[model samples]
Target chain A: MTKQVVILGGGTGGTLGANRLRRELPDDVHLTVVDQDDSHVYQPGLLFVPFGLAHPEDIVRSRRRQLHSGIDYRQESIDHVDLETQTVHLADGSTLAYDLLIVATGAVLTPEETPGLDGPGWMEKVFTFYSPEGAAALEGALASFREGRLVVNVVDMPIKCPVAPLEFCFLADWYFRERKVRADIDLVYVTPLDGAFTKPVASQRLAGLLQEKDIELVTEFNTGEVDGEAGRLVGYDEREVPFDLGVVIPLHSGADYVGRSPGLGDDLNFVPVDEHTLQSKAAPNVFAIGDATNVPASKAGSVTHFEGEVLVENVKRFLAGEDLDASYDGHANCFIETGFHKALLIDFNYETEPLPGHFPASVGMPLLKESRMNHLGKLMFQWFYWHALLPGRDIPGIGADMPSAGKQTETAH
Target chain B: MPTRTIAGATVDVNDEGFFTEPEQWNEDIATELAAESGIDELTPDHWKVLEFMRSEYFEKGTGPTVRVLGKTSGVTVKELYQLFPKGPAKMAAKIAGIPKPRGCI
Candidate 1:
């Protein structure tokens, strides 16, 4: 009897999970991946697209071609999940049953969540790099503008790669400097948080950088609406930020189908998951990963990569009639580019905050630290993403566990 | 705060160390690990490297190259070698707090 596995979303999470399963699972397992379109975008590269550092064509690859030989790729929107019947309904009125299910239908940006956000000035002056179209469009808009106030705002929390907005600001500064119009531009970073970042230590460090770059930092500003016609943003407290150009990371929500499914997800449509096991609270055989789950971790590519490793192991254990391993640490690592050939790296798992030290022990790369080497590593990751990451090959020494070798141990203070 | 036993290490839940919380890490054996070989404490020169490394990571989310570290810290490659006898990988690993470079094995 063949065990059928249906995976929703063919993005990074779904694609990697499927490839790993294909390599590890037996011939008796049937794997099918569902996505809306055939095109798979290298989401991280989207950040660099606006600055002309990366060509849009370089970041896009055919989804089907990336999958394993045996996996089935279906092009259709998921209408909803019938958890009771273990069936998935397609937008075309078709249905498929599976013994096991994986939800990787990453989050979506709702520009409409902010009142007047999608009004007259959207894409013309206000844009978001979260989408491929918005990134490409902003490139042209930014190129022609000689000078004015450029406000980069995060409408709400839990946006993918929280540091990306800051990266945009840094790159924008570098861009204008190169164009010899930097003096005419004013960069302002607006967030709902009290500081520039979530963690206090990181916030203080990042706040200083913002000052060094001459970028204004406005914290705790909860954006209520974007009055595009009026060319301004209105916060909940009625404070207005007038801007010549606004790049907004609007509110984020889980898959559209999640809202339609009853008792499966939260109010935000994110699946209620067992944070440790990556299993869905709705069904024992169902698992969730990436931006689809309500996990208390940054919704970044590294998180998805770490989750895929654990999910594959758990799936194999479940098939063997063994106890499921409840051991998934929310390990997330990211390489942030700070322009001028500098980048920083941080590694933290579920129980570990990002610590300052070298990565891969007292010998490899530095952690929670910056170096031009780190920038090179960031640029090099694109190659690794296409090869090692997507192909499911294990990079030695880089496991699911968070290491403690190089970190400065803090005894009870 | 969540506590779990990983490879005999009684990982503390409230510790602010890297991988210090249950929401961030899991218990998986490392595929390969490099041998440790570097200074444990922060020397004045090491502090120079450490401060620069931490600043860079916070700004960009990656580690620094020895050349950049050298240029920023005003240390020559030969001086860096004397300070970190085992080379950049070992020194970087010691600084990053990771087990070892994944490719080192």
Candidate 2:
């Protein structure tokens, strides 16, 4: 008997999961991947688009082209999933019944959720580099600006690429300096978090870098309204930060379809999964990964890549009626791009915060310290993302668990 | 972890004074924590939000974000700001004997 496996969203997690499952599962199991569109984007390149460092066309490819030969690809909008029925309903009134389901539709930006954010001055003075259109539009907006306070505000947390806004600030500092107008601009990074990042050691280090670059750090500002017409971000507490140009990372939530699905998602529509197993709490046969899950891990591509290894194995185990593997230790690593051709790498998981030292081992990439080598690694990741990561090929030496062998436990002086 | 005496009870607390051991939390301890944050008394409305936070944290292993709390906690966003001044999510979590909601790194 043939078993049906339906995977939602053709983005990073979905594509990787489908490809990996194709390789691991028996040929008797049929796989179908569904998404609204055919274009697969390299999301990391969105950050560089506003700086004119990368073009949109270079970062996008047809979704069908990336999938394996045997997998089925469908371009259709999702309506809802009936958990009890084990079915997915499409917007076109079609339905897919599956023996197993994987929800990978990642987080989406909701600028309209905040009052006045999508209103007047949007794409002119207020811009976001999170999307292809937003990033391309911001390039034009950033080019003409000469002076005044430019504010980069994160409306809230659990956003994809949590460090991108800070990366934008660093890149902007370098961009303006290259244009010799850096001294004329006051850069401010306003966030909902108490500091530059979630982890303590990394936050202190990144905060110091922001200070050295002369960017103002405003903590605990939960933006309630974006009065783009008046050029001010009003927080819920009524605290305000005025801006000449605003780069806002608006609120993020899981796919709207998830919310429409009954008994599947949380308040924000993110699938509640076992933190280690990636098995959906809603049902034993349903699983989730990446930004789609409320896993308390950074919603980054690297996390999705690490999760793919565990998720595929678990899916296989569940089908065999065997005990599922719970070895996923929330391992996530990211290269934080600072300006001036230097970047810092941080590697940590659920239990350990990012510490300073080498990554993978003592001889690997330096961790939590700025270096030109780390910057090069950031640039080279685009290639690895497309050629290696999306295909579910393992990056040798890096695995599902975070390595503690090379990291320094003692605080650095 | 550090120990602090709040409302005559010695409790384990983190650096930010949030209860490290949530089991040590009591209504009296919550009153003292709220008082430190400038809420003179725990009104019925305040307890609604506090109880919601504790239940969500113990069950989910995380405190709810302001957006989540506002949407599902039977508390309106506007009322949440009014009830727990400044940063409602962090402030309410502290008083509710839960660790502050964390941002993903």
Candidate 3:
């Protein structure tokens, strides 16, 4: 009997998961990947687009090309999943049966969820760098600007790449400085969190960087409205941050298809999974990863990379009817780009916060400290992403475990 | 902050022995630092990477990406790891006496 594996969303998680499983399982176990479109984006590059550091054409590659030769790639919009029947229905009225399903549709940015955000001034005066179109538009908008209040706001939490809003402000400071108009600009960062970042240790360091860069930090701001025409962002509590140009990261939720599949997702449409095993709580045959699952980890590329390793191993074990490995510790790492030609790297997992340490060992890049080397590593990652990470190749020495060998545990407090 | 005796003078470094002040770098200090980082001595090949990284940092105010470093340094990425195990950018810069190079967490 031949078993079929159907994966949703040929983005980072789906593509890598398909390639990895293809290599693991026998040729008889057919693997198929479905996506809304063929374009697979190197999402981290979106941050550099608005800063003129990258081009949209350079970051996007065909998702079909990303998968391996043996894997079947379907270019179709997913209509819904019939959990009981173990099948997926496409918008074209076509259906496919599967013995196992992998959901990796990730999150969708809902700009319209915020009143007046998508109504007027969208892709005009107000923008988001999360998408290529938004980033390219912002590049032009930022070019003509000499001086004014430029505010970067987050509508809510659990947005993909949580550190990106902070990165945007840092890059903006550099952008204006290069134009030699930094001193004339009033920069502000508005977030729902009470500090600069989610984690306490990193937030203190990031808050200091925001302060040093002369960017005002607005915290606990539950945005109620984006009065783009009036150039003001109103929080639910009635506090407002005025802006001439606003780059907003809108409210993010899981894919719309999740809504069509009952018992598969929560109110926000994220599949509830065992944060460690990635097994959907609602169904044992279904698994979720990346932004598709409501995992208490930062929704970033690195999290996908770490989870991919564990998910692959556990998927193999699940098929063999063996006890699963409950060992995924939520390991995630990210490069925080600070202005002035420097960046910072932080590696932590579910249990530990971002600690100051030399990652991998005492030989790697410094932790929780800004440096030009970290900036180079950030640029180099785009290359690593396409050539290494997406290929499901194991990164040497780096693993899912949060190492304490070279870490200075003092800062973790 | 931890202090180490390099070039017969006490210098400040983080817990991992990365120099806090790049300006205090000297040849004698680099040799000692290299030895501590597991290199017996700065080979002519090692100097090839270190020198290029130095000029790039001094010119651009930051080190070039490792991909650029591999393309320009005559030393390949594989050789870079052999020379500086684990991480080439920060390890080489720390030993080369330049400001800490940053990227990918």
Candidate 4:
């Protein structure tokens, strides 16, 4: 008997999961992947596009080409899932039945959710880098602007590449300095969080960098309206920040199809799953990964990579009638660009916060310290993303678990 | 692997134009590679980092990170960038004729 395995969303998580699973599953087990389009984005590369470091066209590739030869790729939107019948209803009047299901749909930016965000002046004075079109548009907006109250805002938490907003500010500082207009731009960073970052030690380091760069930091801003016409960000608590030009990281949520599938998703459409195993609490035959899961871990590409290792292994165990391994420790890493050709790398997991140390041990890049090495690492990642990562090939010495051999564990209050 | 004609000799290079095979490298190849990377010529300081990266890769099967280049090669990170505006670790490795170094990710 042939068993069907259907995976949703052919983004980073879905591509890796499908490729890794195709390699793991036997020939008889049918593998199928669903995505809305063929354009698969190298999302990490999107951060560089607005800064004019990369082009939008070069950062995109065919999603179908990323999958293994044996797997089936469907280019259609999902309508919903019949959980009891183990079937998926497609928006194009089609259906797919799976013995096993993997939801790697990830998250989407909902600009419309914020009042006046998608309203007038969206592409004029206000822009977002989360989407390709927005990023490309921002390139022009950033190039011609000399200086003013240039504001960068994070509408809420759990945004993709959480460090990007900060990176944009840093790169903006570098960009304007290169143009010899550094003093003219009053750079302000607005966030809902009380600190520059989530972790205490890291927040202190990042907030210090913000101060050193002379970029004003505004904390605890819960934005209620864009007020694009008035060029102000109106907060729920009645606080407003005026901006000459606004860069927004809007709210994020899982795919709409997840909402259509009753009991399968949260209010935000993210599937509730075991934080360790990633097995959906909704059903045993179902699993979720990447930004699609309502997990406590930061939604990051590295998080998906680390979780894929444990999740794939658990998927194998699930089919063999054995207990699923719940060993994922929520390992996630990010490179914080601090301009002037320097960046910082931070590696942490569910149990431990990001600490200062040499990652991967004695010879790896420095943690929480600015270095050109981390910037080079960030540049080289685009090649690695297309080759090693999406192909799901494991790198030597680097595993899912966060190595503690070289990390400095001195607690900081 | 792809091959590029450098200094009238074809040698293997990756898509990003970094040398994949180190044994086929020579002075002329280094000069040609330097020109392609936007550096006019390999200076004495450039040779120091290049030689160090080549030795490290051939001996340990790994190239030097920026920190390693700064600490061990006696060339400061800032100076390395001045010579190789593209990047220190990557441009030096390309000129050194070694595969891309690991641990950046």
TM-score of chain B taken alone, every candidate: 0.50, 0.94, 0.82, 0.93
Error of 2 at A302 (Å): 0.3
**CA lDDT of each candidate?**
0.78, 0.92, 0.86, 0.87
Judged by whole-model lDDT over C-alpha atoms, candidate 1 comes out at 0.78
What CAPRI class is candidate 4?
incorrect
Clashing pairs in 2: none
Off by over 4 Å in 3: B1-105
**Candidate 3, DockQ score (0 to 1):** 0.01
Candidate 3 lDDT by residue in tens digits, A270-333:
8989988999988998999898988888999999988898888888888878877788888889
DockQ of 4: 0.01
Ranking by lDDT: 2, 4, 3, 1
TM-score of each: 0.79, 0.97, 0.79, 0.79
lDDT of 4 by residue, B6-97 (tens): 89999988997877778999999898889888888788888888898898888656787554565577876557767876557777898888
lDDT for each residue of candidate 1 in A1-413, tens digit (9 for 90 to 100): 98999999998889999999999999999999999998889999999988889888889999988898999999999999999999999999999899999999999998876778998989988999999999999889888989899999988777888789988998898889899999999999998776887755556767887898899999867676797767788865568999999999988889889888777776567797888889998889899989888777888998999888889998898778788888788888888777888877777776676666788798878765668888998898888888988888776777777778987655222
Minimum summed lDDT over a 10-residue window in model 2 chain A is located at A392-401
Off by over 4 Å in 1: A409-413, B1-105
lDDT of 2 by residue, A117-159 (tens): 9999999889999999999999998898889999999988889
- Of the two candidates 1 and 2, the one with more favorable TM-score, higher being better, is 2
Q: Specify the CAPRI tier of model 3.
A: incorrect
Candidate 4 ranges beyond 4 A from true positions:
A411-413, B1-105
